[model samples]
Target: MPGEITRFVLKISLILAVFGASAPVLAEDMLVIAHRGASGERPEHTLAAYELAIDQGADYVEPDLVVTKDLVLVARHENELSDTTDVGSREEFADRRRSKTIDGRLVSGWFAEDFTLAELRTLRAKERLPGIRPANTRYDGLYQVPTFAEIVQLVRAKEAETGRTIGLYPELKHPTFLLQDAGIDSVDLLVTALREAGLDGADAAVFVQCFEVGPLRRLDRLVDVKLVQLVNTNDGPADEPAMRYGDMVSPSGLAEIADYADAVGVNMNLLFGPEGIPSGLASDAQEAGLAVHAWTLRKENAYLPPVLRRGTAENGTGDVLGMVTILEAQGIDGVFTDDPGLVVSALAQ
Candidate 1:
């Protein structure tokens, strides 16, 4: 029996060696992160959007979080609620519609911070880009603004039901604005929620992302889960100037980022040239031992580069699969897409 077992082990080892030497370098499995839940099909940040994303085989679901007056953390792309909700039409919030300088931009709107969780709950979500995504507008007024806790619960339930591990990617939107304007510690609230969900450990399938270095640095000290520093292609927001995102992709900038963040989520433009080919940014981040995840892959021709656009309409279809294929070839660790199914299918190819 011992002699027979030894012969079998040798045979398997020989086969592996033969195949391994001839095989091309295998690529890491590219992750498909549903940007704001399958946001292309539903009102972004709503539970319906998230659920659709999960159904489409997303590995992670992203929620851009903002704070409410009662200090509840809720899913919102920005604190300004006018564009993404039905606040403007509601006479009850008419008096609440006032402009204030937030993060250096003077804006007038019914802000989320002015409403308690219950008040915010009474409102319904709308399509943020109705003109560009008329189909998604069909889902408007169908879902409520989900709280961070509720989002966590939904993801947990999905995981248990589907028997598949899905990650949570929550961005702390405008941390400085929240801290200065409302005296709210957004990171603390996020960390508390993550801990309560039993997802604050180092190995937990959670990524806390922020655009500012200061907030990311603070979060690194508070949470054991992975932290991602988001970089905009343009110079930092006008009201809040910091290091340019271009600089952040530089060797030294990435090195500094590696000190606090396990990964970098950059504007997709940084990974491509005007001719639509791979650039050095992904390789540089990998060299610095930081995982790279690119953002905002939409099907609209307007959102895509000139080289990849398929039509002239603002809402016209583009070669999303072609762009995704190029990005995958660049060896990115993950991608953020409004259409999670497209990315999943492209990656499978």
Candidate 2:
């Protein structure tokens, strides 16, 4: 979404020069944003998970926002109803299973937009990454996806109860495509919800992120809260047939985005590039005046780096140290990990 002009000199900064010694000290103060609440400890997007995240010391608890059929705001990864729920097992709604191109993929499943908020709450949350969270399944059917309003209510109440400011980070998932297909996009609704809850303002502790730039731009035109443009070079918008996300990460691409958004949430791989670990994007990202936040950090070996794998001295039995390593080395403003406890522990150490 850069304008017609683009420029890049690759003037990477030298923050990493003293990083070796600074790693321990920096880890103590790094901002930790819970990926989907304390997902490492509870079902994601459920109020329980988010509440635990705050109790565990998350600077912000994230919720991916979506709208239901009744126009109420709910939380879910994709509007998809299959992977995260028992929607497929319900014979009554079995006919609801179908396919549609969401953000350009022929995805077929029961989608969130197809249900009302009331209906959604009747369903329970499942481990989206069961391979990494088999233990989490013990609590399966224990929690339900919560509404943005519910989260706002909880966070405000927590701020009062704990005397600590806890922020909310929301990603306006697939906004443009939602409008193009489902006739339901939640940015306006989300902004309105924030205002109604007294959480929308320059001083509001909120950060909104999205992979697509169009919605962020549109949201900027609507409200004055912080916004982030998420990037994924591997399978992002650019890779989509009719998508242009690939163009969004380039120097010119990012500069254009910096115009409308407050920061960028690039995939961890992009921060480390194809090389992985020991490397960070502090210099390049800093040049853009954009704060970098990486996502989906977890303790599972699948999500952990080889050197920082489970049970290693460098990373312990969890994913925090390895990730915090990258966070410090790269001078990242924050990160989204399932284990806010681990993140908080790492920060304290």
Candidate 3:
């Protein structure tokens, strides 16, 4: 840990040397959160991915949580498993496949809730987007779908090994659908797990996030740990249609959100308008006394803005440092990235 502390101190000094004394605060406060644990390099939501992210200097690792039939919390981008697991190839679990409507869209797949943790252990994690991240497909059958508790254990072990305090950013996926349609209370399960792990205290390095308002509002009443309201550019929270996401970034909307949320995790595009002018979202949300974190800074050309992209190949790397620089200038509190190593490098520059 002493080495890590020394590295951090050097990093701070380097920031000041390169960008001036005023730059230290922004460099230190802005967090580089691993979106699904350096997902650009490994199958997302697996222990290997999370560990890689931590080793690459990420301040936090994010896990999108879904439940099993036994109500155990596990990390997956969605409740459906076919895209990210070998469940579809397993003959024993073939009958488990079916169609269900989540958030008004009908999706057919092998769902996690249909199997117990033991049943899920037999399936191996795989790249969710093989067409875009074909390199990650090589490790397809190597890792297991990790549980929320298991992830906490991994973080603790890594902290002991690295001597650095790593944070957990867990997002309760489809909270409204999971509770109302699937008949599972993910919030209680998450809180109970955090409580058992001694991570529910106000000082704990945890931020509970949700895309729906009801769950975040409920969590605000249930836990002292920070809560984040995730907003995308296109739509509103599924539970609150009248509350448009576009409007949520407005001064009036941000004021309303500040009542229940400590931070707003928004789409990165929201921070900029047409012609790349500052959209004022970061400033507006901060003005409402709310921290603003931007989502998904990836190196792939497909994910980068046109000006920063290198070529037509969607899978090729782009100028991610330029993207990070733009967001940093907006005074964003944090950034979610698929490549923690790249973001860490960008911030160091």
Give all candidates' CA lDDT scores: 0.85, 0.74, 0.88
Quote each prediction's TM-score: 0.90, 0.87, 0.92
Clashing pairs in 2: 79-112, 237-245, 238-245, 238-246
Report how far off residue 99 is in candidate 1 (Å). 1.6
Best by lDDT: 3
Candidate 3 Cα errors over 4 Å, as ranges: 1-28
Q: Summarize candidate 1's per-residue lDDT along 86-192 as a digit string, tens digits.
A: 98999988999888887677999988889999999999999999899999888888899999999889998999999999999999988888788889888888988
1 versus 3: better lDDT goes to: 3
lDDT of 3 at 104: 76
lDDT of 2: 0.74
RMSD of each: 9.2, 7.4, 6.3
Show where candidate 2 strays beyond 4 Å.
1-28, 235-246, 274-280, 311-319
lDDT of 3 by residue, 99-185 (tens): 999887899999988899999999999999898899999999999999998999999999999999999999998878888877999
What is the Cα-based lDDT of residue 302 in candidate 3? 95
